[model samples]
Target: MFIQSFLLLLAISFLSAGRVPRPEERIIGGQNIEIEQAPWQVSLQVNGEHICGGSIYSNDIIITAAHCLYEKERRLEAKDFLIRVGSSLWNSKGTLVKVAAIRSHENYNSTNFTKDIAVMRLSEPLNFTDKVKNIPLAERNPAPGTVAMVSGWGATSIYPKHSYPVHLQGVDVPILTVDQFSISAGSNGQTACYRDSGGPLVVAQQLVGVVSSGYKYCDGPTQFISVSDERSWLLNAIASIKL
Candidate 1:
């Protein structure tokens, strides 16, 4: 009996060491997060309205999807953009920074979400606070089936009526192979929807992908612009900026 109990304890220890709880799963079905869990998250706004989500790449730079700029009918101007950092509450909490400039991936495809990435220079550096921080870009892609978390203030429902969550929402999802991601979205019905664009797809708390595009009405396979694929361009863009 003593030997059997020791072996059971050892097995439990190994399992605990192998599995780290993802706080995003604390809510049932990944519902509204209670704390400012993802400090790097930012809300991209146009005229005081939340348009999409973004990631705080640096004190003065934010990363998001390029397609977000074209969502409006009018041609985008720098003055039209604003970045809200350091807050999880989408209503009215966070430092608002005016956009200094916008740079989109040169190869960004307007038709599809291919190479759909962008960097926005803040007019002034953000005041890093407890609620505001920067997340590191992923150095390498994890093997397929790695679980990742996507957080945003996007509308929760697609069918009945679209509406944004009162607070930021976090959902845990498995990283499907590129092909499988596409097939799953097309076949099954897991996807990111409106207002989720430009949000970060994080693995183990590291930025790995940018919400690019997906099936319409928020029900389909969503495509993420792989950060690993755009690292070169992102580095160049950051270096070229005067700030």
Candidate 2:
């Protein structure tokens, strides 16, 4: 059964090349969340349209999937992107911040999404409040099978573009070992999906992973760039980039 599922996922992965998240990708079986539940969550938007999810790492730094910016080859200027923070819904009122710069891992390989991580420098420092704050980064990976919480504004189903959620959605999913996750298929309810690319995977409120890619629709397994594994790279980027 696993083999068959793997084959099917392989085909879908090929069909959906490039790490772009399709509209069909979303939170398959998640529940709506309260507005201030995740103060660090941010919605990444391009041309004013909600595209991917992200998380605030500091007053001026946000972490997300590299594909969120690299899907297009052209260099992105700070003006081309906007980040919505302090809101439960993607389109609802929030603190809109402009991008000052975007830096993706130098070794980011789009073909297989290796090192698929990126950080954005906000144009200005965000004022911290109960509804807007940064989340701590995980110092190490949690043990396998640990339950992690993932939240996002992706669609609620695999069907056509379900209107963007008016409220954020969240789900608790168990962490699968690298071996088990590597062979897994698309999201199966509790996993991240296309709309969730660049979303944060948190364990005990510490950011541990960044959503990279998932199945074509929304089921089975999802892949995340482990934040703990790339801690050095992230710290270097954060330090090198001046506010």
Tell me, by lDDT, which candidate is best: 2
Which tens-of-lDDT digit does each residue in 41-104 have in candidate 1? 8888876777788999889889988777764334477788888777777767677889998888
* Model 2 lDDT on a 0 to 1 scale: 0.73
Clashing residue pairs in all predictions, respectively, total 1, 8
**Cand. 2 TM to true fold:** 0.84
The 10 consecutive residues of candidate 2 with the worst lDDT sum are 1-10
RMSD of model 1 against the true structure: 13.8
TM-score for candidate 1, residues paired by index: 0.81
All candidates' TM-scores?
A: 0.81, 0.84
The C-alpha lDDT values of all candidates are: 0.67, 0.73
